[model samples]
Target: MEFGVSTFITDEGIGAADLGRALEERDFDALFIAEHTHIPASRETPYPGGGELPRIYYRTLDPFVALTAVAAVTERLVVATGIALVIERDPITTAKEVASLDLISGGRMVFGVGAGWNREEMRNHGTDPATRGALMDERIRAMREIWTAETAEFHGEYVDFDPIYAWPKPVQQPHPPIYVGGESERAIARVAEYGGGWLPRGNVENLGDLVAKVRDRAGWRVPVTVYAARRDPAVIESYAAAGVDRTLFFLPTQPRDETLRTLDEFTELAKRHT
Candidate 1:
């Protein structure tokens, strides 16, 4: 099982290029950052992790831009979005962004995506929360078409386009892996139907059975990657037993040395299992 770190990557935190080089130097497997295009002033959606939502959520740097900076400095570290809001972006433009990043990073992008939670935030982007899932699905399907075809065309409720030539195909064959996030049944189905892997938010429930069910239903053995945000080595082993392929440890702060210390500690702890 590979070990990685998930950080906020906000404007105040360690810069992307610095963090990327640090993670690589530490021998970490990957570095991931979460996304929120912009947080609304309204506080309707309570943070899943509790307490006041940290500044990082509102202060996050754009994932693609940040990842690009990281990619420029690192040779082997996997740079990824812990979760990109697919419901609020254009599929064609995003496809091009993913392809360009993959080429720049030598195919080391993991396109983690989610429908998002804040209704007001989605509304700001002109996306209705009621249809976020459907929109997300269509956007992903359209992205796949763009990445895999020389001249791609797609027609769906949320994404429709005529055949057009898109250039700089991703370095990884068929494009970098698209990992779907969230725990809903629909989320699992979406991953099985279109994604390269299942990215489950860390929770107490045993997802082994659900993972098996999704794979069986899809007829494709997609790997499961656990967020493992606060889980210990024992818990990680349990996830491995449950067939998890990779685990990401969450770090919500920005202090470079402090975060790096945590990474070193987790790296040592994770080495026991590897």
Candidate 2:
């Protein structure tokens, strides 16, 4: 039961370099940053949390650049995108970024990706909101091809490319773990089909039910990571009993002191469970 923390990497938050050092000092398992390439002005997609989006979404730093800064400062603290918006990014370039970050971090990169829920945001990237699931699927498949093949090619509805060589293959064999994020049935299937794990959003009821359904339906023992707003011990125990491999706590802000305290608390939680 490894513990991780996710926060917005904004201009005003703790710098990624400092955050990395802090996590390493506290011996936390990983540091994940959430992503939103560029939120559109149109308010077509309601906030998943049922409130106005945070200003941090617009002020956030690029995830790869921020994680790279983190890698430069830490030795063992894993870095990741809590939910990288692959729908808005190019899969080929994204694969190289993941590989480069993994190499720089000594293979401690977890790629958590999702087909985001913002309709206007996807439209801004020229992606159809209705078909994002299919698009994301092809992107994941294409990325795997790029990561594992000496000369790779993929032909799908959303992604099609001729043979091309990709350099600096990921240090981790067969590439770093791709954790599919979201709770829909299609999302679980996507994880089983291409990802190394499933990253279910927080606020899930019946953790055991969902974990069992995913395992029974997908026929994969992929890890299920819960991203939660609260880290109550009882809740953690319930999730652990349900076979969740890791539970990442969502931090409200990235202040160094507050984050340090949470890391210590969560580390204690991890010690008890793991």
Candidate 3:
């Protein structure tokens, strides 16, 4: 299985382009960056990781824009949104951004997405917290039309648009791979339906069973990619043996030298896996 780094690239860390080049240089297969438009100062949503929200969450660069830089500088690395908050953005505009990034990167974009956990943040974007799952589903469905059709339109409970022309359809036919990121059964079903792949976090329980279930439903059409996978070789090996297509280990947010030092360690882990 291929191995890579998944990170939150921020204003204070090693720049995205530099980090991307470093990953490619070390033979890492992909670079998956995280996203957060803005964190609400008054947010009551507990951090999913279960503690005070990390400073990185507030300092992240826009995933799409940072990835554009990453793509411009690296030739072979796959540039992706580790999990873009589709529930917090307009589908039409976001579609163009994804397609544009795909074109710019010569078809090497993976659209990893989720309905995020921050209720205040979602509200700030004019999205209702209660119905975000449906909103995310429809937005993704709508984006598919934008990427594929010359004149596309979609009418759904959450997304409604008339036929419109959007330039620069993605270089990858039908668009870049959409790796739905979550651990729920609904997420697994979504993969069977329209997802190009799956991006469940590596800590998920009963991962082997989930992998088997997804494969049974969609055959090889939906490959499983485990993100933020443990750095341990044994852990990564377990994922590979369970039929994971790729494992992206977490990279700590740090400046150039510190980041590179940690990357060297992860690179060694990748060497064993790759």
Candidate 4:
């Protein structure tokens, strides 16, 4: 199985280019960055991890911009968005950014996306929290159209556009692989319907069963990538046995020395499994 690392790229963390080079040097498969345009100040939305929100959430660099810097420095490392908040983005512009990054990176972009969880955050983007799922679906479909077609157009309840030409088509044949993120049934269904793979959050109890469900729904082999997987050799082996295609461990956004040390530890874990 491929091994990767995901982290919240913040201003105080290791620089993107530096981190990318480091990961590649360590022989890691990918570097996935988390994205949040801006965090709402209100504390209405509880943190997913069930604690005070981490400081990195508010200080994250734009994933596309950060990943571009990563791609510039790395030759083989897959640069990805661990979970880009598509609900807050313009599909047309996001499509171009994905394509441009893919082209410039020699087709090494993985477009991992989600509907997002923060209600007030979605509101800031003029998106209704209740309908964000449907909106995300339409936006993804619309972006796929923009990526593949010479003259693309899409009309839906949430996304409507006329045929227009966008250049710098992705180097990957159709487009970069879209990995739908989340662990819910709806998220799995979305993966079956439109995504190239599934990006499930880590520490699932019955991961093999989940992988089977996704494959059954998709009627094909759907790649399953476990995000935030624990950096344990046995855990990695368990995931591999459960048919995981990749396992991305979480890297704390910290100082360069500390971050590299964590990577070194994870690299040792990877060696034991590989």
The Cα local distance difference test for each model comes to: 0.85, 0.84, 0.90, 0.92
For candidate 2, give the lDDT of residue 142: 94
Could you give the C-alpha RMSD of every candidate to the true structure, in order shown?
1.4, 1.7, 1.0, 0.8
Report residue 165 deviation for candidate 4 (angstroms): 0.9
List candidate 4 segments past 4 Å from native. none
Residue-pair clashes per candidate, as listed?
Answer: 0, 0, 0, 0
lDDT per residue for candidate 1 within 95-199, as digits (tens), equals 999999999999899999998988889999999889999898889889889999999999887788999999778999878998888878888778778888888
Residue pairs clashing, model 3: none
lDDT of 4 at 64: 93
Give stretches of model 1 more than 4 Å off.
Answer: none
lDDT assessment of candidate 4: 0.92
lDDT of 2 by residue, 1-274 (tens): 7777888888877778988887788667788889988888888778877899878888789999999999999999889898899999899999999999999999999999998888998898999989888888889889999999999999999999999999889999899999888778788777778878888866788778988988877687878888763667788888888998877877666567776776677677777767
Error of 4 at 172 (Å): 0.9
lDDT per residue as tens, model 3, 176-196: 999989878788788887789
lDDT of residue 201 for candidate 1 = 67
TM-score of 2: 0.94
Model 3 regions lying over 4 Å from their true place: none
